[model samples]
Target chain A: MSALPEVEIRIGGIDVGVEHDALLASTPGAGACVLFTGAVRGEGGLGALEALELEHYPGMAEESIASVVAEARTRWSVGAVRVIHRVGRLLPGELIVLVGVASAHRAEAFAAAEFVMDYLKTRAPIWKKEIGSGAERWIECRERDADAAARWIGQHTPTGESA
Target chain B: MLKLRFFASIREKLGQGSLDVRAAPDVVDVASLVRHLDAGPMPGCAATLLADNSLVAINRQLASPSTSVEDGDEIAFYPPVTGG
Candidate 1:
């Protein structure tokens, strides 16, 4: 059985410099690497976003990501997984978060990377406060996120399985 | 007794980040502890976060309502995480 890979979790605004290094180092033994970065957009369907604040349940947040990475390890021949998320005020076009996975093949790497992201969106304890033109409000969980996570329920699937 | 910590928005809303509670032996469970804390001097924001949902962890493990708590254990409460 492949042992669990190194998992790093950092809470900060996204930095390409940091992310690139992590991705490069984690890719050494892996045949494929998948990196995903999520950015804050001007609009989130709520309205025009002026700024956004993200809050997280600190201890639980870290533990949850660790568990997700561990679970991915069990299901695939993964090499390393790094998850970094920024908390605090963010502006449009700014990077919000990143997930990088390394595995023996593109299939495992890509699937595990996407799986970690899907679970993180729904299961992790993070909240968003959107500052928009009308008023600032706590962002509600989207039904889309629930649906995204739901698709992974029982099957050993890949990205192509969904959109 | 256990040390309970709050972080991020929960900490900001509560006005303070950490607290200590003397846990009665019979009340050494997460649900009981949450009930006790809820009845304490937690601020409105902190209280609101727990009104319907809040994440709980016992010693760095995602804890359920039935999770056990013991002396010196660290219990934390906070809002849902949105981090990647």
Candidate 2:
């Protein structure tokens, strides 16, 4: 097997397809590759939004995500994990983050990708603000997000010990 | 000197990313330090760091109210994250 990076984490905006290609390259031997992308959308009262602004702790945000990825690695027999997050003003329909996982099986890839994203939403030191016509407000963290992340607390692989 | 940082709504409410505070000797833990910073009604000056919803990190690690801190430590206070 050729040497390839196990983790590909970047804290900036980039072309999603290109990053996905890189992830695909890193997962040469994996049987399953799952990738998830998040994009800004105007929902509910945000329909009139002009843009969504993101802010993050310079060094802390990246490290926080890496820590979560490491946990996913310890739990699943995954081959690769790729994550990229964007910071700054992003218009509606612009991508915000991407998570990809490659593993020997479909279950592992799907779970790890979901795991990383679930943790990132509530744990990463990044924040979002909605901007509209002459108005701006910080996006509040949703209770459902915390629940989503928390539900995985005691979950484990079928053949592995509890995580 | 210990570096105190703020982010998101807290940074906006506090009006700065970082603060220069030569932490007092009496300040031993995060809770006390947060109290020290929640000084007044002035924007960009005093922050309600002790609020229940406020989150903290010490040297980039998620920290709690009881997290011990010293002069050289880096402490940050921010709101619950909203990143995906």
Best by DockQ: 2
User: Candidate 1 on B1-84: residue-level lDDT in tens?
Assistant: 688888666666777878887877556688777666666644244354455667778887778777988888888876665554
Candidate 2 CA-lDDT value:
0.79
TM-score of chain B of each: 0.76, 0.83
What DockQ does candidate 1 have relative to the true complex? Answer: 0.44
Candidate that would win on lDDT = 2
Tell me the lDDT of model 1 at A76. Answer: 72
Residue-level lDDT tens digits of model 1 in A59-103 = 566677778878877777677677877777889998777888866
User: In model 1, which regions exceed 4 Å deviation?
Assistant: A1-31, A157-163, B7-16, B38-50
* Fnat of candidate 1: 0.57
lDDT of 2 at A19: 57
lDDT scores in order: 0.72, 0.79
lDDT of 2 by residue, A23-123 (tens): 66677666777889999886525558788888889889888898899998887888768888888888888888888887767888888899999998988
TM-score of chain A of each: 0.83, 0.86
Candidate 1 residue B6 C-alpha distance from true site, Å: 3.5
Give model 1's TM-score versus the native structure. Answer: 0.76
